[model samples]
Target: MRIIIVDDEMLARGVMREYLAAHADVEIVAECANGFEAVKAITELEPDLVFLDMQMPKLDGFEVAELAGGKTRFIFATAFDQYALKAFEVHALDYLLKPFSQQRLDQALAHARASLAAGSGQRDAEAAAVSAAARDVAATRVRPAERVLIRDGARVHVIPAEKIEYVEAQDDYVQIHSDGKAYLKNQRMAELEEQLDADKFIRIHRSYLVNIECVARIEQAGKDSHQAVLHDGTRLAISRSGYQRIRAVMQ
Candidate 1:
């Protein structure tokens, strides 16, 4: 079996490598220290399995998985327990928490081997089903993010939430508009909506999430639909339901 290990920490990678060296059936094809490298390596190597770390600079494991799709099987090894729910939602082959023992690693590898032998058909089916459900309701209610991360080529941007004018859904990603510029971030609109302070941001349409402070006026487009004019003159479609929701922010 061919495998690739992806993690930001050299120590973590070395430990995993040391443990895997004893396995006769597996060949270590490549190692990546970040999501960008992981994406490139996985695309080129197309290894049978990947050991993915959830938290890394730039793109996280979920974003990498989003970019890679479900072509390669994955076993998550990360220190974070927060992603446990999201990891299972994607129907990953297995998850390994940090500080794992050789025995635990062996158990996860055994599961990966069995899944490989059975074929990827079932995994693909469950992945598609879960992925669809996950995006529809991705995050939970709590403290909203004060700053959001965006990756544009080699440049990583950290935009403050207060400066954001609005967000629009684009395919699987969202375009965050702020300060006369736009940045595309790989995240679900529903998930993002839940993360932003409820009093500051409101969903004005199924495709649009607007910062309440940026809304300049509400224009009646027709009897059934309306438009939300931002301070910069950017007009956004407002659904009937959106019009009602706008009342909270308008006050």
Candidate 2:
């Protein structure tokens, strides 16, 4: 099994590396110090499994898993057991809480081995499970997200929630417009909307979600039709239902 160990802590990496050395069939492909490096390595190496730390600079393990997709299996390692349920919900092979014993690491690896051998039918199911879990995780977040993380290849763009002027849905993706720049993120519009502050962003149309603070005014488009005029002068149509939703928030 080819593996990558990702953690911001040097000692943690060393301990994991040492523990894995006892397994002759396993090969450690890379060690990443942060989530960004982990994403880059995971994309490049396509390892059989990853030992990912939850807390890291740049991106958290959950963000890395979301951005990396469901190709490689993961066994998240974190100090917080609060994430264990979420990790399993996303179909992660397993997770090891911090300061785990060598025996605990072996158990996680055994889980990964079984999962990988379960054939593509099971893999497809796991992928679907992760997709659904991602939406649940977003909607149930303790607080509305303060920022949005977008992965562009190996690069990550962190856009503060307040800077997001609007989001436009394009099929399976949502185009996030912020600071005069547009970023395409592979997420459903409704899912993305759920992650943002509900009080600040309103779905003005099936295709568009706008920041209330960015709206200049609501203008009449035609008889029984209305549109949102943004501070930047861009206009977005508001559906009858959308108009009702926005109107309540606007008032």
Candidate 3:
């Protein structure tokens, strides 16, 4: 299996390479010094596995995984245990604490190989469970968004969901475009759809879901897609399947 080692420290990367070299089935494709480099390498090389480091200069491992979009199985090699819970939350295959033993590294490799063989089935199951649990939590959790919560740096600004014109998917995040500015949230389009009021927001495409209240016009695009022009003049394409659903609601 092709693998990439991502660590800010040169020594960590070297150590991982040495440990992985003992495995005949594993081949080191490249080594990255930071999360941004890791992201670029993963996108271009499309390695089967990644030896990810938790902390890096610019992006960090969590951001890297999010950017990768589950394309590669991640085996986190970190000195810190604090990120273990968050790593699993992202469905990481394994976590190898720093100063790891060859035996421990081997175990992580075994788990990663098994997970790769299962493809995305295990991930899908985990996602389903998470979704179900999130539903339960949402039921009990206080509704913080009478409007919306705009995550600006370390602080969160709550705005009304009704004011949201539309949302666009960017990698693992969704850009919540409202009145004049856009807010970035760590969420998927599908997840946001479930949380938002279905009556007010409608998914117009795989990458976009818009507030029906903010839709100014629907223009024909092609045989299998249509463009929705929002009140803010943002043009979003609607897939044939999504267009049908939107049309059904309108009718």
Point to the candidate with the largest TM-score: 2
TM-score of each: 0.76, 0.95, 0.58
Candidate 2 per-residue lDDT over residues 1-251, each given as its tens digit: 99999999999999999999989999999999988898899999999999999999988998888778767788998898988878855568887999999999989888888888898998988878876886677557778889998889878898999999999999999999999999999988988888899999999899999999999999999999999999999999999999999899888
Candidate 1, TM-score vs. the true structure?
0.76
Which candidate, 1 or 2, would have the higher TM-score against the true structure? Answer: 2
Question: Candidate 3 lDDT, tens digit per residue, 101-126?
Answer: 99999998998888778867876886
User: Which ten-residue region of model 2 has the weakest summed lDDT?
Assistant: 133-142
| Top lDDT hit | 2
Q: Clashing residue pairs, candidate 2?
A: none
> Over the full model, what C-alpha lDDT does candidate 3 score relative to the true structure?
0.79
Candidate 1 segments whose C-alpha is farther than 4 A from its true place: 80-82, 128-164, 169-197, 221-225
lDDT of 1: 0.86
Global lDDT of each model?
A: 0.86, 0.90, 0.79
CA lDDT of 239 in candidate 1? 87
Clashes of each: 0, 0, 4
Please report how far candidate 1 places residue 75 from its true position, in Å.
1.4
